[model samples]
Target: MLEVDGLTCRFGTKAAVDNASFSIEPGRFVGVIGRSGAGKSTLLRMINRLETPTSGRILFEGVDVTALQGRDLRRWRARSAMIFQQFNLVGRLDVLTNVLMGRLAGVPLWRSLIQHWPQNDKAVAISALEQFDMMPMAAQRADQLSGGQQQRVAIARAIVQQPDIILADEPIASLDPRNTRIVMDALLRINKHFGITVICNLHSLDLARTYCDRLIGMSAGRIVFDGAPAALTDSIARELYDLEAGEVMDDAPDFVPGELTPAFGNVAA
Candidate 1:
């Protein structure tokens, strides 16, 4: 389980996240919903310590990951895998090789640099690919695969890490309907099959309602509503999105408006 307690992140005078608190249990699939700049991504980043919080405690299985530094921090991050929106795979590397890289934290850096993945890592990577039915593309370069395939490969990498929690940030933002289903399907399977806690940052309520066991709504840097999908009323969405009655939309198809380019660049939190 993941416990985020009184989390706060400050950038200069403004707090990107303000005393945010939430807990997720194992095998639970939860969604974080908010308009851009609601501090959703910052909160996720803090989970793995990519961004440090100004004040707060984040306990991962009773260990305060927020207080760790150096080696301890690295270990905590490895325990919780992060899936980026851009599918942060090395395009030049083969899918299998990239997936095996997840074991690098445990392997000696010198050995990893020499591409000498241990036998166990190789078997683990292969098994992860088989789980995703991505074995056929294992030898292919990451750049050669489709967007959905790359995302699966990324998940396979996470699988090999044996993460207790998976943090996905707008994972389907760049995909079409079919690809979106493909990625979300894999995520749901991972959560159910492996009992890994999943906290996904989502743009579409449809996807959230379909896959999440619970949904968390955020606005102006705080979680305004946190509950089951059935409990998400229209008024909650309006308050979350700052929309008028008629203009309010629920579960619209995920879209990436070109103007929101560099999404959340000048995020006001």
Candidate 2:
């Protein structure tokens, strides 16, 4: 569903991502693990055409994504969407309205500005929220919802778009244990039930192990490891994260997903 080849990104003189290449098949789940500045975020951004790659190719379902621009880029972006760590949403808009924004690409800007969507769009947004048990809070303002609710709203927004692929960057960085589990379960359910291809970048190796079918490890802007969870060990984690002896404890917390909490309850990223 997604293919990347010889991808590179440079900031001034420093290359943040170097010649990265990978492909994601439909219904496949892959976890991205790497040290900070390992190019994980850059890779995801390039896939969605949100960041301009300094060099290389990005193809989704056969079209060259790097060459897409204007309307082509807009359509492709809607097809391959992203979920960010920030859970970007209008704080004052109601939850349902936030989800409805997913249909922006299809709706006229004037109609969207009026918030007078067609009845079918409303139905689609409501059903998407229902998948995450978010229908009850649809009328609540985005800021009025808890953090977990907000993330669910975000996921619902993604679902409403009916994207063929979902790219999530550090999706679990802020939630508590329960909220994390809820969000992860939701993503897994979406991937399994809807067969949407998923590529997620996660900081927690244990979470990657628990939920991902394959792992892609990175360091210094290049992929160094790609395999199953059992293939990644303490030594491997150290290598991917650029850690030295005793840098990470033996009993590091396993990344079990928990329910997302309110932003006030969000732990430090």
Candidate 3:
């Protein structure tokens, strides 16, 4: 459903993403794993056109996404929704209203400016919230929700967009273990039940293996490994993170990097 060819993004003397190329099939749940500065975020932003590539061809459904302009680009972005790590919602706005913002891409500017969504649009947004069991909080201000609740709200907004694909950039990086599971489960359900293609950037190897059907590992802005979660070897994972086997284990109470034994073993506590 999506293909990236020889994608490159440079900033002055540095290249954030260097000739990265990959493709994702429809309804596939894929995970991008890498250490910091591995260009995972830059790669997703480029697909969303938030970051223009220095050189590359991004094709979606056989069309050249990189060549689009203005309304076309806007329309393309609407088809590929983005879920940011920070839960980028209007803090003061009510939860339902924030989700309705997803419709702004298709709605008239006057209606959006006035926050006057038609009943159908409101129903769509509400139904999205209901999917995540967030309807009870619809009247609450976005800022009043907890981190996990806010992330669910963000997912609701993405769902209301009726996107073909969801690009999640480190969606659970800032959450507690409990909240992390909630957000991950939500994404997994969306991909499995709704069949929406989901490409998530994940720091937790265990989480990636648990939720994603395929895993793509990056090193220094390039894809180093692409395969099923069970096929990811310890050596390859260490190489992707530029870490040695001895340094891969985490001693934190909530995480046991040591437990990551055997193929597709639990990567975190």
Candidate 4:
């Protein structure tokens, strides 16, 4: 389990994430939803230790994640992989090499510098690519792939890391509708197949309801709602997004409750 107690992040006088607290069980798929500037990204960054918390404790199992430093911190990062909004792959590198980069923490600096990857690691990388139906593009440059394809490559990289949890920050924010479904399907497959805990930040309410087992809603910098997807009514969504009834009904079309249309096809598991 993961425990976050009074987690807070302040930017001078402004609180980016205010006294947020939550707990996640193993293998659960969680979605964090809120409007822009709701501090959702900051909260995830704190959990990943990419951004230091102003105060509070984050504990995984029995380990104090907040106190880890140096090698300990590096190990923690290796265990918890992060997928960003912009697919953070090396544009010039081939898809396979980019996936192999996940093993850099375990590889010696000299070997990595010389591009001398172990055969086992290479096999693992190829397996991940095949799982995502990205094996055909293994030799292609990351920059050449479509947005959805790049995101899948990014996911393949995360899988090769063999992480216990995957933290995705607005992963589908920039994709087209079809690509959005494809990306979310890939994430859903990873969670179920590997039993890896997934904590994703999403802007789409329908996607969150369709994919996540639980939802955490934030407003300003505070967590205002936490419950199963069905429990989040339109009223609660309005409150989370600070939308008036008229705005919710007319202005914010995406806020209305609806089913997420199924993807054209599932990526290979």
Q: What ranges in model 4 sit over 4 Å off?
A: 244-269
Please write out the lDDT profile of model 4 over residues 1-269, one tens digit for every residue: 98999999999999999999999999999999888888999988888899999999999998999999988898788788999999999999999999999988888889888889999999999999987789999999999999999998998999998999899999998898767777787888888878999999988777788789999998889999999999999888877777533342342124222223342234332
Order by TM-score, highest first: 4, 3, 2, 1
Q: Candidate 4 clash total?
A: 0
Question: TM-score per candidate, in order?
Answer: 0.90, 0.91, 0.91, 0.91
Off by over 4 Å in 2: 244-269
Model 1: how far is 190 from its true place, Å?
0.6
Q: Model 1 segments beyond 4 Å from truth? A: 244-269
* Cα lDDT listed for each candidate: 0.83, 0.82, 0.86, 0.86
Counted clashes in each candidate structure: 0, 11, 0, 0
- Model 2 steric clash total: 11
Instruction: Give lDDT for model 4.
Output: 0.86
